[model samples]
Target: MTGRNSGATRRTPAENAQLALLLEVAGTPKPGNVDRRRDLEDLRFEHFLAGTVGAGKGLRRAEHGARVGIAFERAVAGMSRQSGGNTQFGCLLLLVPLVSAAARGDLTPDGLDRVVADTTVEDAVSFYRAFEHVDVAVRDPPAEMDDLDVRRGEAAAPTLRERGLTLSDVLALSTGDAAGGGMEEEARGETDGEPGAETEAGTRGIPDWNAVDWTTGFERPFAVAASIRDDTGPIGDRTARAFLEVLADRPDTLVATSHGPAVARDVSERAADVRGDLEAADALADALVEEGINPGTTADTVAAGLFVALERGLSV
Candidate 1:
């Protein structure tokens, strides 16, 4: 189940991660998100295919101690040029480190954490560069830090530099609690001395991006991976179920960003009701698309989960 090698006559871990991304997008009736049968005006199935393949290859070839931010920037830049649009930005953020960890012959929680802790300030710079290359929509930052707005893109680089924030620092700042407050409150012990401190106690003693559920430890991905691993059925069914479970468990941050907290909460509740009911889930998926409510962050997490599942040799 290790990610180091796929054995003779098998695809590499990078290839498996790519396949997982493609299959996740291809899974039909996946609620509000895009699938093989559904496509957004600016985002299409082909765009995802190109992005996944390009980013997966870039991640596969990345060297140890390489700045994940730089790797992410290169992957997204290539994808943007090829697809002429933004697709899989979040997927790349989650997968690049996993790819790097697998390359190092370890995909365990501890292994991945070590990789994340090693990211540098240059990595944070590269992250902001990637943001500039895309047209991602996110919620506004705190009122006090207008310069930190992601919408500002590379324009925020100087501020990031002045503050000496690393990639993990940026992620920690963006990480939000269920109540949508800053991470400061919930990140007490997990982070360093300051609430929501960038670093953790162990490992490299550097910033702890794993402080948030979405960033490190691959928490959500691991949960969904375990679900997919336990399933013994068609890959499509397993993927759909895993997506439902994730959607039901948490309100999608992307949804909250685009719409609002209310819409995100409603979608989560709907997912909970439809979970475990294939027919109901299908109907709900159609209704969500009609309503223009996409649980995109959930879909991104699902892609990462599929990657983990594949890396671990889950049958499918």
Candidate 2:
């Protein structure tokens, strides 16, 4: 049921509904500690659910498309913080829907946004590519990126803020205005420490720490889902879905993948293969591959491999 191998075939109604849920959840903002790993798992599940229920039997294609956009936007928003507002994350976000649409032969990412929000194709591409490693998503800027790249990301930060294009905005764009706006408000309140936001957290009614904690060790979920979504080679839909399910069912796999890069980074500084010190670079690519996080038709498998090497301090 994975879109990668389905040749962009229509999704089942349940899959569409689940996609809606994933978009909603991912777009909603949370603290810095929010678990992306779990967020991705939910998304994968939604995809699976949609297929299980049958398309047209439940959710319409348009409804599914809208929700898909929302899910992507949310992932971008949630991950943008770590992406350091770089094109890597932004590009990843922007590219998902376009890629998905193109793959399905139904929509182009740029065309949909242009029609829905009056955005230009160039702007949409720029916004998505903004996730480049030097952007805002990084917890700490990488040493390898040129100062100009770093500045570029910083400069773009204001546009994202002004446009209210948090990670959720990426998802909302697909879901529609109402869903996107509501999620943005939630993210804003959470970031600002608003009353309902604070009180609702850890309480029964709203999304809170409990929600975060319930989806513990999200790294594997993200890695696996990203890998499946981003996969573009010979893999089949069933294999891709199985990959994600494995990650969701066993959270440790995500952590394990994360660990490989993390450990590699720590041990490789100043080594002959200096390129390997770029853990974030490698980690991001690997996670993207593992989770199929790209928005374009082509998967950056080469980049993912490079990043894996970088994470491990290995010479490619």
- Write down the lDDT that model 2 would get: 0.28
Task: Supply the TM-score for candidate 1.
Answer: 0.84
Instruction: For candidate 1, give the lDDT of residue 183.
Output: 17
Tens-digit lDDT string for candidate 1 (73-151): 8777765664536667777777778777777777778877777788877887787777766666554445777777666
Q: How many clashing pairs per prediction, in order?
A: 4, 68
Candidate 2 segments exceeding 4 Å error: 1-100, 103-125, 128-144, 148-241, 244-316
Q: Who wins the lDDT comparison?
A: 1
lDDT of 2 at 194: 22
User: TM-score for every candidate vs. truth?
Assistant: 0.84, 0.25
lDDT for each residue of candidate 2 in 41-120, tens digit (9 for 90 to 100): 22332332232223222123323444443334344444333311221222232224333333344332233343334333
Question: What is candidate 1's CA lDDT for residue 213?
Answer: 45
